[model samples]
Target: MERDIGDLTIEIDRTLCIGSGSCVGLASETFEIDEQNLVRFQDETPDIDPERLKEACAVCPVDALRVYDGDEQIVP
Candidate 1:
């Protein structure tokens, strides 16, 4: 799944995700981990700082989360 939050573009690779709650735990407004432990979004525009947002994406254990700002990838 994909979502745009402020200037960041977040792409989640569901197949790669390990059901880690890191993203949701850091930015609840931007991400939610379901009962099945998959990630979902609260909204497109999350109320969070850019670096913090990137950190949320960075914390995903499987590298399932990708964050982009325009054409640049901010998170691995």
Candidate 2:
């Protein structure tokens, strides 16, 4: 799943997600864990700081979260 958050684009790869809650822990307002234990964007996400979002994505142990500034991938 992918969505535009400000000037950045966030992507969540369910197949790679291990449901560790790392991303959610870091950015609860921006991300959430589904019943299936996968990372997904929050419905009413506030204006997210790009760096915080990037950090959240980086915290994913399995690299299921991705942040893109235009065409460049900014997170692991």
Candidate 3:
């Protein structure tokens, strides 16, 4: 799943996620761990800093989280 936040786009690959809370620890207001321990976006995500989002995505050990700027990927 993905969402456009300002000029950046954030995505979560549920299949690739390993139930790690790295992204949640960095951006709780933006990400959450579901009952199945998968990462998902908050229902009402606020305006998040692009760099913060990138940091959260980068912390994913399984590379399940991703951030993109237009057509270019900026995070793992």
- Against the reference, the lDDT scores of all candidates come to 0.84, 0.90, 0.91
Q: Relative to the unseen true structure, what is the Cα RMSD of model 1?
A: 1.5
lDDT of 2 at 66: 85
Ranking by lDDT: 3, 2, 1
Please say which candidate is ahead in lDDT: 1 or 3: 3
Per-model C-alpha RMSD: 1.5, 0.7, 0.7
Q: Write the per-residue lDDT of candidate 2 for residues 1-76, one digit (tens) a residue.
A: 9999999999899999999998898899999999998888899889978888899999899999888999998887
The estimated TM-scores of all candidates read 0.86, 0.95, 0.96
lDDT of 1 by residue, 1-76 (tens): 8887777898989888888788988888788877778887775554689888899999999999999989998789
Best by lDDT: 3
Give lDDT tens digits, candidate 3, residues 1-76.
9998889999889999998899999999999999998999999989888788889999999999888999999887
Best prediction by TM-score = 3
Backbone clashes, each candidate: 0, 0, 0
What is the lDDT for 47 in model 2?
92
Instruction: Rank by TM-score, highest first.
Output: 3, 2, 1
Poorly placed runs, candidate 2 (over 4 Å): none
Lowest summed lDDT across 10 adjacent residues in model 2 is found at 44-53
Clashing pairs in 3: none
